[model samples]
Target: MSVEAKNLTFSYEKETVLRDLSIRVPEGEITVFIGANGCGKSTLLRTMARLIQPEKGAVLLSGKSISELKTKEIAKQLSILPQGPTAPEGLTVEQLVKQGRYPHQSWLKQWSPEDETMVENAMEAAAVTSFRNTPVDDLSGGQRQRAWIAMTLAQGADTLLLDEPTTYLDMAHQIDVLDLLHELNEQEGSTIVMVLHDINLACRYADHLVAMQGKSVFAQGRPEDIVTNDMVKQVFHMNCHIAADPIFDTPMVIPYGKGRKPYGAIAAAEAE
Candidate 1:
């Protein structure tokens, strides 16, 4: 299954955030959206997830307009994790994860063995099984983020949309979360779309990169092909050197700014 945004135009009040944007999300791959702040990356993700309605055009899920589908039906096929999600004060990790099964449940089937299995598997996948009984409020930031991701995984949707899933996370925790998502994509063949602020991480992790600028896609392709020093300068308004990551062998962006000195230069100066 694939998700496509066709000629999408979205606005807040009188100001337009995204205009005439069109892109197709490749199925069974990790796609990352990158841009500077307020470039409408998050807004575009939200629009595709149906969290926000578009002022013009439509989001199509497998050739069908998402607006035409029932809410529960859409939930069964697509799951979304918005930025900075908050749970109720006293909700436990298990309780929150169990909520993901709501779309598959009805009056005739409130709870079932299938629901229990899904929740258990989801917690295991997210590495939050040990904290199942703990209240979400009691968990650390990383733990809580994993708990939330477990809930999204429990939904068993083919397409997953995330907005800044690594916001406020330490470097290690950010990698942990992203590694979990990468595992899910590889194991389950799920389509993953996320808005990310860290361009280097995006380039390292994304199978397909969508770089937005001026409220539209500036470029879209494999990170190796799309990420360039000129593209970085144009999109981010900052000078950067585009190099290959020694580890991932993908495009790496080294930004330039005051007080930012290259390690090799510093070492050379010290030697002199």
Candidate 2:
């Protein structure tokens, strides 16, 4: 396993977020965490990334405790893209990407050809090479997100953990960002773990899906195997039809409330 939490517990002061949760993120696959707001999907991800220490148990990276690893060692092994990442004002895309190489820098070598190569390759892989000179804050939401992804890519970590990568993006831009991540997972074999609110999109993208409920995993496995009507109702507390996505053959949720029912199946108020 690239990363796994062993009976981890965490709390935001008094209220517990993760309570004795344990799950292994499969290597070189896309694993998505799904849950309603404040259910601790993001909090679990934070523990996996070592951003917040667990109150009990441990997070193990490659079978070793993450807390025991050096900061640079951890940085070189895993990269994180937190939600709503921001760049300094007037920071060009290239400059931002270059920052990813900081962990590799030491008193011996300030910069190297390998660093430059990684930056270039990362920009190319993320398709943000054209925007290398553009200010990160000046680009569209999708482009800016890609630029930030490039920086994380430049870190050369085989593992990636992201929090709500598609937040604030339009449908098209959301697909664009997700497609980029999918490609990275498919082509580079990167171990990816993410927290996503859109269950349909998560089903489409995830190789392994973990559903959170009451601050613990409700179910986890292949989306097709674990995503059922009952799972949705319990995890999200909403009645939904579990339909296959026409394009991807993944589970698509048709929520049964507050929408126009053109077939006159049921009244909107009745669906509630």
Candidate 3:
């Protein structure tokens, strides 16, 4: 599925969060949005999800305007996993995953084997199958996050949007979740778009990278094409050395201090 935003603008009360923003997420690929805080990343994401309407432009799903599609119909075409999800007290993992089937069901078409199989597959894919009977509130942060992702997966949508999906996860769990997301994109050909805080991680995982600065797209391309030191300095206002990662050969950043070097190197050299 393809998501295209054309001249989108969003405002809350009197403040504008996104202004004249336009982006086209590659179809059937993982695209990561990276930007400084309050740079309108989440706002743009919500607008694309149809959670918030744009005042100026439209977000198109496939070829149709998302607003023109019925809410349930849109849910079937795309699903979003917000930054944080709250489950009702005592809700089981199975119950939470089953909720994803709501858009696919009606009074006349209650539960079916298809729904059961989808839920089971989602749980297994997220590695949350063992926690199916466990209450959502009882799971750890990572496990709970996985359960939420599983629910989104069960929606069976062609496109998935996630906001800060790695938040609250330790380093290991962060990679774990990202790896799972990559696997989903590879295997199911789902269009995955997300906002990520870690630029290096985004480069490592994203098939396409979109960098935003001051409510506009600073750059968009493959990681190697967009993640240069100049882009980092322009967007983040920090000096950094960009190098190729030994592992993935992606761009890696090494930050420098303000007019200083490690261990007072200048002072030590003067003494010598």
Taking all chains together, the TM-score of candidate 2 against the true structure is 0.95
Query: What is the alpha-carbon lDDT of model 1 when measured against the actual structure?
Result: 0.92
Worst 10-residue lDDT window, candidate 2: 260-269
Model 3 TM-score is: 0.94
lDDT of each: 0.92, 0.92, 0.90
Distance from true location, Cα of 21 in model 2, Å: 0.2
lDDT of 3 at 214: 82
Determine which window of 10 residues in candidate 3 has minimal summed lDDT.
261-270
Query: Residues 1-272, candidate 2, lDDT per residue (tens digit)?
Result: 47989999999979999999999999999999999999999889888878999999899999999999999999999999999999999999999999999999999988999999999999999999998999998999999999999999999999989999999999999999999999999999999999999999999999999999998999999999999879998998887677789999999988874353423443443466
- Candidate ranking under lDDT, highest first, comes to 2, 1, 3
Question: Cα lDDT for residue 6, model 3?
Answer: 92
Task: Give the C-alpha miss distance for residue 63 in model 3, angstroms.
Answer: 1.5
* C-alpha RMSD values across all candidates: 3.2, 2.8, 3.3
What is the lDDT for 15 in model 2? 99
What digit string (tens of lDDT, one per residue) describes model 3 on residues 78-172?
89999888999999999999999999999899999999999999999999999899999999888988999999999999999999999989999
Error (Å) of candidate 1 at residue 98 is: 0.3
